[model samples]
Target: MKSKYYIITIVNVITMTIICFYFYEQNKLIEVTTNNDTRPIELLKKIVIDSNDKSAYNELRDAYLNEQYHEEVLFYSLLMANITHYRQAYFDFYYLLKYADRSQEMKIFDNETRLLMIEYLKKGAALKHEQSMHELGDLYMEGKYVPKDTILGKKLINSIGL
Candidate 1:
């Protein structure tokens, strides 16, 4: 009778440990699925369907930023700008201007787009984005986008220790 009781207790302990470990692993799997299931293109389509979804915009922005999607970053930045989401707009625009090629292939080099890019760059510079400040300073020094303002350009460059 004593031996049977001991065997039963040992079996119960093993079963409980296995059950606890199984549940813990299931919880981890759920967490991973939740993190990885959100796709950027799907979020973009959702944004297109309902442009007022702020959370979707934020999620798409974060996802695309993580993926290093430059054109999508520019698109979302401009969209945010149109909605007056200035902080996110500035961040996204700064990244786009800092990393993207402003040629025809990127479809962002037209005169109007160039002006818009400069506008966002100036706003980003005002927010103290170092790269935007540097790029805008270079543009001003070279008269590439806005009218030449060498004084402001030099001022910006000096501010960044470059």
Candidate 2:
């Protein structure tokens, strides 16, 4: 009847809208990947398994180049926090705090990354990472991120050797 037709039409419209929204998000993520020339995390994983693979690197670069603004910002932010690259765990912790949550699925590298950061901080207080020392100093002064330990903060800053 007329009522049934109206309901059907509304359901179809809603379904189409949902589909459109999904594609829009996909395009946005892809656009972000391209603009920054960052490879999608998936592609980056392949390159990790094959360090000398130029093709993988090229794919990564291409994806970044095609990425959108927001995606690039997020990508670079994560890149900066990469423990293997920076080893300054505090920066990663603070940086991740912006977007991370318990419900999020753990990436393959997440555990190792966190462990390395913790180890680096504990062993040498991020000796080569200037920002870590600064953060440590701030944490000591503020007693917010870390326990109040002025002596430890001073020693960490000095250890950075910056």
Candidate 3:
């Protein structure tokens, strides 16, 4: 009877220790995450590698968005487009739209990336950027940004005339 009691006590203590350790580790992770460090990007990379970690994915995406990491935003957007096509990818797509450099534009690609490209062109047009107007006209002419509507493309090109 004494041995049974001792074994039960040991098991109870071991279980409590494990639970406490888990909480402690979890709390530590929270602390690390809250700190303004680039480690969150690393964590995001890990979550990308393990698609099963949905919570981690959300956290990492939020962190990257907050940090304004354009490349990371583009990557996650494309990844989501490829895997799930979730609406959140649109938010990342918008981020990329606002920040992507012109030199990097060629790399911004996916089946659904046209929507983002069109948004960028519109933004440029709104800002009166002649280059964007020309690009948009060309894309329209070539059926890149939208279905080829030669009439509309010619109209845009003639309006821009460049």
Candidate 4:
């Protein structure tokens, strides 16, 4: 109930922010403050006061996202993935891990992080997360990380009608 409103409010705020940015870009007279620190601290305090506040947590995650705090985003995203067990959360993890830096030894991620990413994806897929299945399947098909199994990739993708 409350969460739905929070989501809508967040969406509205994001949409306005985007519109403001576009206008600011063209006019060069207005200054956009996407990097404002006021929001994160307030949200953090709210979270500290009540750790179970999902709305605060969600807003804090979005704040981290807006601030481009990758590790913080990843941490909250991992928690969300574990807590919600939803396709969107798993997709967040997948999207972050996909863009993570690789080692000079041709590793997609550091060994532990890579394994963790794979483990999360596998669990998400087993739980029938559509995005997880699609991304894991894509990984298999790409043959970049882990063993390449086109058959398995196709199977996973096809399982989701992708």
lDDT against the true structure, each candidate: 0.60, 0.45, 0.54, 0.60
Ranking by TM-score: 4, 1, 2, 3
Instruction: Give the per-residue lDDT digits (tens) of candidate 1, residues 63-91.
Output: 65665444554555655655654555665
The C-alpha TM-scores of every prediction are 0.51, 0.38, 0.37, 0.55
Residue 75 shift from truth in candidate 1, angstroms: 3.0
Count of steric clashes across candidates, in order: 0, 19, 0, 0
Candidate 4 lDDT by residue in tens digits, 1-162: 989756754554354335434543454322223244455444553463346454555565566566555445455555566566654556666566555554234544455455556766787788888888888899899985669999999999999996
Off by over 4 Å in 1: 1-62, 65-68, 84-88, 94-108
lDDT of 3 by residue, 70-93 (tens): 455455554554365444553444
As a whole number from 0 to 100, the lDDT of residue 92 in candidate 4 is 63
How far off is residue 65 in model 3, in Å?
2.5
Displacement of residue 45 (Cα, Å) in model 3 is 2.0
RMSD of each: 24.2, 16.0, 19.7, 14.0
Candidate 3 whole-model C-alpha lDDT, 0 to 1 = 0.54
- Steric clash pairs (candidate 1): none
lDDT tens per residue, model 2, 34-68: 33444565566345334534344345434543442
Q: Ten consecutive residues with minimal summed lDDT in candidate 1?
A: 26-35
